[model samples]
Structure formats: structure tokens, C-alpha cells
Target: MSISTATVKERSLLGLKELSRDEIASILDRAAHWDRQQEKMSPILNKHFVANMFFENSTRTRFSFEMAEKRLGAQVLNFAAAASSVEKGESIYDTVRTLESMGIDAGVIRLKPIGLLAELAKKVSVPLINAGDGNNEHPTQALLDLYTMKQHFGELKGLRVSIIGDILHSRVARSNLWALQKFGVDVKFCAPANMQAPELAKYAPYVSMEEALQADVVMMLRVQLERHGEGVLKSADTYRVQYGLTEERAAKLNAGTIIMHPAPINRNVEIDDAIVESPQSKIFTQMQNGVPIRMAVIERAMK
Candidate 1:
């Protein structure tokens, strides 16, 4: 698609890579405001329409955004590619343009194409919120993560965060890296050699699992076995022995340190099932936090 030189009028939340510290802080603060409200539904966005155009499958993100939009009283339209014209070979651009032409105020889109969201943003006049764009970024996930950490630790500056697992294929990892670095957090990555993103080496060091476990936050990435080439790693059992947050490894964490994961967890693969909801784990809290953070994002996009 050809890029447009015309000015884009809408305020979109595409990613955190270009967001300044103040801008991110503003979003988090607004999320906190929404979270503290007494009423369940606020009609701040009444009469506005928001369409969730998911070219990829999701449960948590799609539901979370829908919940947020509804809470603020916006009408929503959910689009699933598998059941739509997309399955018949209609292009993604056409699908979004069709919605835009129908007068949707903004779009929440998720897709596997890495740079397609950016290209679509140029072509579409309505605001676009990226649900996830390949492995490039998942901004709201990272924002909720920051909110979860901040709620626990009080301040984020000088915190040490180690993100471990499939670094090469995790949009969560990339989003967290960019957002955390803005807050002066020391971020580290721990993954198998083949799973490392070499381009990010200058931004953060690739550390050993033992070293990663020592941080203030030990965040595990989902082991995307499907994204890996066949035989790239031995097996899930072998991966657990080496990199998974087994019960033994969890015992070694500092009493003050917290464990986290972006879920649809692989049970015993990336992390032991016993440790997922333990006192030290904030895995589920991350999901709960997503609603408000996304509410803040949608409010920003529409208002």
C-alpha cells in the first residue's frame, strides 16, 4: 500500500516505542482514575462506535478491550477474520475500510503482519488502536504491566525487570522493554540463543536464567513452539528443566520479588502450574489490570 502524506487527525495508540515518559504516565494515571470509579458504566463515549477488527485470534485482549469500551458507553462491533470476508480472500485493508466507511469512530486491530498496522494507520482516517502487531508490540499489555508493577512497588524508577523466554517472538517482551526503559527500569532478557533478538542487544543484555531470577520482577514469556522452527529446541520437558519457572526456581526468588506472565499459559511448559496463582505470582492480576489500561487508551482515542 502506498503511504499518504495527508495529516492523520485521529489520536491513536499504536505502540509505546515513540511515546514520551509524560505521555505514558498520563495514560497510567487516567487508568487509575477509571479503576477507582464507583459506577460500573460511564456514558462518556455515548453515541460513538468502536470496531474491534481482529485479523488474529485472541481471548484476553479482545474481551478486555470490549469490556473497556462498554464500560465507557461506546457501541462496539466485533470482527473475526475467520468468519468474515477475510476467509474468502478479501484484503485486510478492505475489511477495515468497509468499517470506516460505515462510520465507526475508531478501530482496535490485531494481525500477524508486522508493519501492516502502521500502513493501515496512514490510509485510514479513524483512530486505530493496535491490539497486537505481529511480534513488534502489544502496547496495552505493557501498559497494564507497568500499572500492575506500580501498584505493587509504589515507584518504577530503579526497578530491575527480567523478561525471560521466547524473546525473539514475544510482542509482550518488546512492548515491556520500551515502556520500562522510559521509567529508568533496568530490563534484561533471558532466552535460548536461537530465541534472542540480536537487534535489541544494544538496548538490554541477554542474561542467564539465574541472573534473570534475581531481578525485582521475573516475567516469563509464553513459549511459542508454533513460531519456532521444528527441532529448534529439544522438547517442552527439556525446556522446563532449563528455562521454565519450576517450583525449585520459584523457591529461590527473593521474598520481595514477584513473578509474572502474560497468559494462555502452557500449564507446565513455560511455568509450573502450581506457581501460576501463588502469592508471589501476579499473572492473573495482569489480566485484571488490562481492562482499565485499555479503557484509558480507548478514552484517549475517542475523546
Candidate 2:
């Protein structure tokens, strides 16, 4: 079942930076083909069992990975942290090894702590796909996002993308930044004062929301209130005026500019309700693209 490309076929995709520009392009291209094949079933992982280990809650990522597994004609096992022996304080090593012992071919994991993926990967024989690890990375989400952009404009080179919101706390922001950087994209970071990612000083430090709106894509990130408490974020009205992708901001977008957000968008906060549903918004399309991109990843990971 091994593909000719061992680097992609055998290894797990923990971060977008692990792939070269060519590899990224290849995944995007493969995603396009997979998107076309959506109505059909692929026995790529027929009878193979894949476990979903979600230490943190998620709507799109968890279900999409499960759907991708089912779509590929594989059996899926859901690992519920609350229901399992994890309540007995069983270690992650024991939990993963216990699942691996049950004959899982691959495992998709999402956790709140960074470095868990690498540590767990070492403890089990199964291939590990990082759904999201703390504020560190979400490679598959980034892949689908890149595919969405590619679908719209046909290429990524020279494209300018502004990522606005909880920059320091968004795994989505980090993953997209890394992947987009490889494609020669003009990536900019924007966030409320303390929320900005200081690590991205090399990428224009921080741009005003108005300035960021001029880019090819104005990507919005959720305020991640869970990480940075409600007390830390501004009042809703003030935040809307300053950072929200409002109607005024959307109207000012240069032609060919698209609005994007990684979902569970904070209504009237990081983005306005109108712009989220507007013609210029690709927020929904990004979610739609997630399936095919994940299908490609799961299919490849089982190889």
C-alpha cells in the first residue's frame, strides 16, 4: 500500500511546514481530484480501523475526520475521554497503546497541550495525524484553507492574506501562516494588543484591521475566549468597530478580495454577521473544502 513518495506516504502530517512547496501543491491538487470523487466511495482503507482521540472538544475537525474515515470505507472508533478509563487517570501512553493494541491502523488526535502529538506518536505504532495541538498547529485545517484559496484564485504565489484575531492562541493561524509562507504569500498578522502573536514579528508584526482588509484575503480568527478569558477581550461593540469584519470593511475590500474565518465565528466580534453570510465570504466554502482535504490526508496516512 506504500506510495512512491515515502516522505508523504509514510510520515504523519503534524504541521504544514513539514511539507515542501511542491508537496503542498500536490496535496491541493489531489484534494481537487478528491472533491470531484465525492459522490463515490473509495476503499482505500476498507475494513481498516482508525481511532479518533480528541482530548479537546471540536465540531468541524472531529466530525470531518470521522466522516473522512467513513467516506473512505473504514471503521472508526471514537475515544471519549470522559467515558473512558482516562477518568481513572490512565496515562496518555497507556490510553494510546491500549487503542493501538485493538488494531487501529491510524489515529487522528486533537489536544489542548502542545507536543502531545509527538509524545503520543512515540508511544504507539499507529500513524498519528495531528488534528490540532494547542496553539501550535492544525495542518489539515490549513490544507483545506489553502485548497479553498486555490479554488477561488487558481494559485497561491504572490497572494496576500491577512490573519486577524487571537493570533497568539489560534492553532489555525499558526498552521496557515506556516503553509502560506511556503507559497510565497504575503501574510500579515493582526490582533487586539495583548492577543497579537509576538513570534510573528518577521511577518509585519501587526497591521491595523483597515490595512489588513486590503489584502487578497482577509482571514479572521476567533477570539478564543476559552484561552484568553472574556475579561481580556474588549466589549462586543468596541471590538466590532475596531476589529470585526463589518459591512463597511467588507465593502472596502478590493475586487477579488475574499473574506475568510475559521469557524464558530464570534458574531459581531471578530466578524460581523452580515459579512459572514455575504457573497464575498468564503467561510462556508472553507468548511465544505475540509472534507476532501481530510479525505486526501486520511487516505494518504493509511498508506
Candidate 3:
């Protein structure tokens, strides 16, 4: 599809890579509208049916998507992979098609495998919101992260954001890099050699934690212990000492720097428990913004 066509109608938010700058701006604008409670009283999505099909366990993303759909006055069908026929050798394509067959307006999915979502995208005509897909991208998470930043700083251009943690498995990091780059937000990744994503070199060369602490925004990624390659974790204590955001390190940051993490935090693993509650931390606010940002996405997508 042409850029113009994409701008008006995005079928599935598979990844931020497919979104143009104008499209990103439009989504953020709509998100702000929801954030400020400026939405119409009449439900924009009345009678629409949406499904949240999560193959992986989640506390935030799955529930937030359900909340977003309901707030828009859409009926929700929640599907858990553990209890579903997915365990019975059913394919992702067949499952999504089954939902579409039931007249579901859209589907939100979080799958463990990387490319299954793209395959489902090809087979289904209804819109799909990627909740999280392996190490690929989490487009809505990036949208809410950007929305949170805008609420605090009012703009993105020229602002520096330092992302720290398990970059290779972080869909959050990849999606944010795409949006940040479009908005002219300078980005740097800080991670141990074992955790850094090499493809992110174009954003900014990987920097030490000490070096990245100087940025306007300090974003921490959850260390994906579940997906770390074999032998990459020699010692958790060693990682914390070198890269984790301990209280001592948090105290050293610029007073004006915004601390963020796309949470389900690993406590003292990615960031210290004390720092997670610090005045500078926007982790909770990021979670709060998820609903509105997701509401905006569902509203725009089903239109």
C-alpha cells in the first residue's frame, strides 16, 4: 500500500517499522484525547467485538487491552493459550480465522514465537494489535511510552532517551527506537555485551551506563531471563553491579531526568526496588497511559 493508504488505514500494527511519522503523530494525538477524557460519551466502538488472545502469561498488556476495548464500549472475549485448543495442535492461523469467523471485529495477540503474528496477519482480514511478539516489536507499548514522555516533557524532538537492559529480547526497545527516531529523539542503548542488540547501532553506538545516565530520559528494559541465551547469565549479581539501576546510581542521575521502564519489573534485577519508586520514575505512569493509548489504537484501527 502507498504511504497515503497506510496513513488512513493500518490493517495490523505488526511493528513500528511499518508506521510513518504522520501515522505515529496521529496515534499520539488520539491518545492525548483519551488521556484528557475528551472522548465522546457515545461509545465509538459500540457493539464491536474484540478478542484478547494471549499465548504468554501477562499482568499488564493483556488486561490493558481488554480495558481499552471495554472503555470504547466493545465486547471482549479473553482467550488464554494454556486453556485453549492451541495445546491440541491447532495453528495460530486457524485460531485467528476462527475468531474472525465468529464476527470478531479485531484481535489482540501476544505470542511467544516471532513470525506467527505475521502469518496470522496474512490470513485474517480483521485488524490485529500485536500485544507482544517474541523479540520483534510492541507497537502499542512504544505508543504509550511516547505518550507518557509527551505528558511530562510536551515534545520529543532533540530529547535524548537512554534505553538500558536486555535489548535483544525487548520488543519495547525496538518499537521505541523506531518512534523516537521518527520524532527526532536521540537514543542510546546501554547494556552488557551479552544483552545489547547490534541492529540498534544506527540509533547511537552502545554507551556505558555512566555515559547514558546523562540523557534527558533514562528508560530501563526488563531483563528477559526466560529468553536469555545459554550461558549468557554467568551471574545475576555481576550484572546488577555493572548495569542495574541501583539506588546509589539513581541518586546520581540528573534531577530532571525521567526514569521509565516497561514493567513487570525484575525488581533489583533491571532496576533497584527503591529506584523503581523514586520521584523521577515514570514506570507507574507508563502503565496508566497504556489504556488510553490502546483505546486510541483500537478506535483508529476499527475505523
Candidate 4:
């Protein structure tokens, strides 16, 4: 069935609270089906406009969102922090107001500092989509990740998923926790003592890397070097030993357990190159699914 045909509740997705479990499942299913049909069908037929405001550097997410919008026949306007009035100390609210005045249908924003997107969502008139908001959340990325896991494991219910490395500074980890919990997946967080997700017990249990590796899906997130000041990690070897997914560690995972990473991998650091390229790795699929899943989100939001 077409995404437009799905009965998504009438709500703005400022957070996951607006979506029911069934709505999330329907979106993912429609995304998968749309991915296959894009070769033959044009999903976005009418003219549309979408604005992408990125206050931080990005590669996969920014490009993937742009591609998704274009694939659905929407005109995309890119706003970079460096080129914007933020150089002159313009407030984020003012910038968002300026963009809203431009009459865009929706905005995809990535910002540093937690809760920035939520704050912006409060002011913007159009639908506000969080691309990545500091260490807070990247809802779409999490959605795509869940979609990838569902594809690999055949279902999300009761699947044990472990998210390892730099959890404190990762928006992906935060979003994944919410998404996994929403779908009834058993979730685990693995990171250094100082870098574990803040207030971990409030959401899900925190575990050591060893325990997390035992799960059916192992996700490794890149360390945000920008957030961690210079010389904080000391040495790559030290980080790798404590938190990296080495080949030996990969060998310990249960058979059919999927290895994943949200990309721009720090090879030999968070993941051994061999495991990243292995047969069980779904990292590439996660990246590939971004386009279709994002298309599904944009379509649903606009309607």
C-alpha cells in the first residue's frame, strides 16, 4: 500500500510520543515497499519545497535527506551554519523565523547542544524534522536503524540490540533507545564509565561491552571528537581495547547477530575493518535505507 494510504495519526512529530507502535510499524513497512518500487514508480509527483538547516557538519544524513526529498520531487533549499547569519550572533529562533517566512512546507534541522530542535519546533510553523540534535535525538536515523534491524532480524519484538561506544555524545544512541524500546526490543548500552548514556537506568539498563556483544544486534557509534576535547581519549589503542569491536569480539557474537555502525567509521577504533566488511554487517544497508525511509517520513509529514 502507498504511504499516503496509511492511517498515520494527525500529529506533528516533534517527538516519538505522538506515534503509536502500529503507526511506526506501518511507516517502516511502507518505506521498505517504497524502496523496491522507486525503480518503477514516482512517489512525489506534485511540486514541493523542503528546507534543510544544518548547524553542524554532516555527510550521510544531510545528503541522504536531500536525495530523499529530490527522489520524491521536492525542491530542497540547503542552509549551512557557516554561511548563515549565525556568524553575526543571530539567534536560532530568528533564523528559524526567517526560514518560516520563506513559506517552506517542512524543515529538517541538525544542531549542536541537546533540545535545540525541540525549541525550534516550538517556533516554526511548518513541520520540524530533527536530523540530529546534539546528544538528544536523531529520530529519522533511529527510524531507519529500526527498519534495518527489522529487515535483518525479521522482526523487532524481543530482539536483543546492543548500542556500544561513546553513548554520552551520540544523538543516534539516544534516538535508537527510544525507537527500540517503543518496538519492545530489549536494549543495552555499552560505553566507557564516564561516557555511558546519561541517566541510563531511567530508560534501559547499561551494560559492559562484553554483555552487549552477546545480543542479536550490535550497534557501534562513532565517538564525537568535537564534543570530547583534544587529548581526552589519549590513544586510539586505549579506546579500542576498552570499547572497540575487535575481530575477536565479533567472533563472540551469536550466529546471525548483525554488526552495525552509523557511518564515517573510525576504522581500527570503534570497529575492526574486517567485521565492518563482513557478511553479517548491515551498515551499508542502513545507509541505503535512509533515502526511502526519509521519503516516507516527508510524504507522511507533508500530507
TM-score of each: 0.97, 0.94, 0.94, 0.91
Better of 3 and 4 by TM-score: 3
Model 2 TM: 0.94
Residue 105's lDDT within candidate 4 is 75
lDDT of each: 0.93, 0.83, 0.86, 0.80
Model 3 misplaced regions, further than 4 Å? 1-9, 38-42
lDDT of candidate model 3 versus the reference: 0.86
The candidate 2 region of ten consecutive residues with least summed lDDT is: 1-10
The positional error of residue 56 in candidate 2, measured at the CA in angstroms, is: 0.2
Task: List, residue by residue over 138-236, the lDDT tens digit for candidate 2.
Answer: 999899999999899988999999999888888899889889999889999888888877877785558887788889999998876666555776576
Regions of candidate 2 where Cα sits further than 4 Å from its true position: 1-9
Q: Supply the global lDDT for candidate 2.
A: 0.83
lDDT of 4: 0.80
The candidate with the higher lDDT, 1 or 4, is 1
Q: Candidate 2, after superposition: displacement of residue 295 in Å?
A: 0.5
lDDT of 3 by residue, 1-303 (tens): 222334423756878887899988988998888878865343778878988998888868988888888888988899998999999999777888899899887889999898888877766777788999988999999999999998899999989999998887788999999988999999999988978788788776799899999989999888877665477976667778888998888989998999999989989887998888789999999999999889888997676
The residue pairs found clashing in candidate 3 are none
